[model samples]
Target: MTTSTERAGSGLDDGPLTIGGRDFESRLIVGTGKYPDNETMVEAIRASGSEMVTVAVRRVDLDRSSEEGILHHLDPDEFFLLANTAGCYTAEDAVRYARLARAAGFNEWIKLEVIGDEKTLLPDVQATLEAARILVDEGFKVMAYTNDDLVAALRLEDAGCVSVMPLASPIGSGLGLVNPYYIREIKDRLEVPVIVDAGVGTASDACATMEQGVDGVLMNTAIAAADEPVSMARAMRLGVQAGRLAYLAGRMPRREIAVPSSPVGGMLD
Candidate 1:
């Protein structure tokens, strides 16, 4: 029997996470928001061992006279910056943000989010798909943030999105996989990467999400809102790795009756 640690070390974890023809070693993608300070955010990101970081274009202070900015904290050479259209509520607004992100010298990689309601922050599927098509036609590698609707996910994929990110729950609700079956269904049908994007509360939530056989997870509030951000970041990193290893190793079947771990005939009567 191969131990989980041994299996993880034996090159079973060697496959790079490929999306939009880009490869990443780490499957956990962190976001640059809600952190108390830039230094703390940087530390948390480094501790998480995340290779990709998502930034909201609307939140950036483009008119700042100083050179210091979120971009300064995130080294482009070390991290793949994923510019997001977080505050955009319509297809046109999302497209405009994508253009602004491109003009900021970030590549055409976009995390497209078209929100419908301020209360729930749930994605507007129709608008999201519309923006995705527009962005894809303009040569952007779109990673769409959408609701956990399988049909909508397929539509986004058909619109040429590089990845389909279905929400586990409402944004920042910390609800944690309210409808996991839908996510699994989306993963089963999609050829592209399927990433769970929101409502992960902690390490276990992330672990559960990964064990669903999805490609990756993108989270912001979970780590930032933790009591100790850096420690939480480390926990998330380990949880993601452990969950991926467990998925690859294959879990033992659950039984309704008690089963002996050792040989049943070997015990004294």
Candidate 2:
């Protein structure tokens, strides 16, 4: 019998993840938040091996001294900065932030997030859809962050979003795939990339998301809040790669009856 480990090595080079006409080999998309310091953030990001990093537009001070701002630490050549409309509660606010991000020289890519409640931080589906539609029509490549509602996800896709990002749980909750069924359903129905945006606590959470055949994951608190952010980042990177490999390799089915690993007939009683 071929073991799962033996099969995992093949077909790893599945090809690049293309979003909004850009191709990236790294499927892990990280966030710039909740870090101890800027130096640590840079090191952790480097260790994560993520090609894209999400930045909260409202949090950035564009006019601040170069040495004091987050943008100074992130080299554009090393990573693709995905400016997100985090903390925006309304469609207009989200849209305004996207424009500000673009004017700051981040370009057309935007991660659209419109929070409905302060407690759960769950996305406001109606406001999210409204913002997404407007952004898409305005020529911005929008990656919408929405709840794990299949209908909402479909509507976002219809609104011309380049990718649909569903939450595993509430943002920063670290609940880890609260509704896998919904995520799977979204993936099955949508043609665009389906990325799990929030609620990943550790490496295993990320691994599980990738095994669901998601194109990628966007996490912040997971790595930033870890005891060792750099080490955790590396773990997440490996977990994502391993999970992707396992998914492509196909897992063995489980059986009710006991099955011996060695040859059953040849074994001595």
Candidate 3:
């Protein structure tokens, strides 16, 4: 049996291992939150071709733990399980939850998000940075979920996070990149990988983020809420490829005049 220990960084290394020794194959990470059902979520995952999926770790209901429908639906081996401390309010709480997740079946890869404010769903940078630093020191590969604040992003990167996952818009807003330039700047300045984490509405939004040189995109609402999730998933896959290809291909400069090649007057003559 291929245990999580043996496969620690196996599939993840298909692409780049950004930080803290965790690797990822595809540049896209899909979140398992906000989907309509288990089947649809599974379909979306298959369509997206995403190797990593985010799973939130809350207090498992002691009474109904065995009957938790959603938990059972997820196949641990199919996707790289990135357990997140979504409901945590403090650094200590987040760290404890991460430990708990590790104790459970989930791996050491954690999406460290400490959001005390429910309205904005924005991360508490102070607490987030503290938690991230501690998590990194404790040997967990921290993928810090943060706001689009470049300063905070840099702080998280400096704190030894595996990757900085900044929100494209507010969580579940689906408004796409409110300020793409900031994300672009982060990609430009930071040494570690930057993944656009939330609020992307369509495939174009994902492409836009990738075009800005972001290492990857993490989306939930955009695909989950789509009228046809499978179709959306396919779109996202193509969009990611298009964006990556464009980035690598490099665009040509704008020209004021067209240079004629095959004898401009030959056709008329």
Task: Give the total clashing residue pairs for model 3.
Answer: 3
Candidate 3: residue 94 Cα off by (Å): 1.5
lDDT tens readout by residue for model 2, 1-269: 65655445434447788888899888899998999998889999999999999987655458775586677788988899999999999999999999998888867999999999999999999999999999999999999999999999999999999999999889999889888888989999999999999999999999988888889999999999999999999999998887787777677897999888887686676
For each candidate, what is the lDDT?
Answer: 0.90, 0.90, 0.83
Question: In candidate 3, which residue ranges exceed 4 Å CA deviation?
Answer: 1-22, 62-65, 69-71, 253-269
Range of the 10 consecutive residues with the lowest summed lDDT in candidate 2:
4-13
> Compared with the true structure, what per-residue lDDT tens digits does model 3 show for residues 181-243?
898888888888888898888999888878777888988888988999889988998787667
Would you list the clashing residue pairs of candidate 3? Answer: 12-23, 12-24, 15-25
User: What global local distance difference test value does model 1 have?
Assistant: 0.90
> What lDDT is reached at residue 189 by model 3?
81
RMSD of 3: 6.6
Which has the better TM-score: candidate 1, or candidate 2? 1
Name model 1 segments beyond 4 Å from true.
1-6, 10-14, 59-68
TM-score of each candidate?
Answer: 0.93, 0.92, 0.85
Query: Which is better, 2 or 3, measured by lDDT?
Result: 2
